[model samples]
Target: MVGRPLPLRDLGFRSTMELVAEMPKVVRVCPNGKGSVVLKGEA
Candidate 1:
């Protein structure tokens, strides 16, 4: 979703998995900001 850890934590998400659990529509996460896919959505 986002490229920074602070933003994710600020959103009340303990981890990427936690955020993914809440947002099923999130297809992937680009944490490195280099256009890489960090995590893939299960939903």
Candidate 2:
């Protein structure tokens, strides 16, 4: 079966398509009122 949906950080377009399905502790954190997403993961 297909795994979890790929995160935005691992999404890209290149000469070839490689999926970096690294599961991270994602959270909706607004650090100092900045971004909305935080991905503490590996590549």
Candidate 3:
């Protein structure tokens, strides 16, 4: 029998923050006037 590796969805806070910080800069805007900016990336 062959074993497959498990996929990791969440990397927790430390790793997640690091990844977010290293991500490319993007222009985020609130079109609905929600006063919140969101990161835009490839779908």
Candidate 4:
């Protein structure tokens, strides 16, 4: 999103929502880089 569109296509995705849906498999809900919650999370 910040640099190029090719990477998204390379990943075989056409939308941001498609990318986001796969995020949880590779990312955790906690461990925020700045140590704050922009959105609520379950304990």
- Backbone collisions counted per model: 1, 0, 0, 0
The sequence of per-residue lDDT tens digits that candidate 4 reaches over residues 1-43 is 5675647677888875566556765544444688763332334
Error of 1 at 4 (Å): 4.0
Best by TM-score: 1
The regions of model 3 sitting more than 4 angstroms off are 1-15, 25-37
Estimated TM-score for each candidate = 0.41, 0.16, 0.26, 0.38
Pick by lDDT: which candidate is best?
1
Worst 10 residues of 1 by lDDT: 1-10
Cα RMSD, model 2: 11.0
Residue pairs in clash, model 1: 1-29
* lDDT of residue 18 for candidate 1: 76
Kindly indicate the candidate among 2 and 4 with the higher TM-score.
Answer: 4
Residues 1-43, candidate 2: write the lDDT tens digits: 2696545455553221223222223322234556443433433
Clash pairs for candidate 2: none
Error of 3 at 4 (Å): 14
- TM-score, cand. 2 vs. native: 0.16
* lDDT of the structure predicted as candidate 4: 0.57
The sequence of per-residue lDDT tens digits that candidate 3 reaches over residues 1-43 is: 2594323245433553355555556433324568655656633
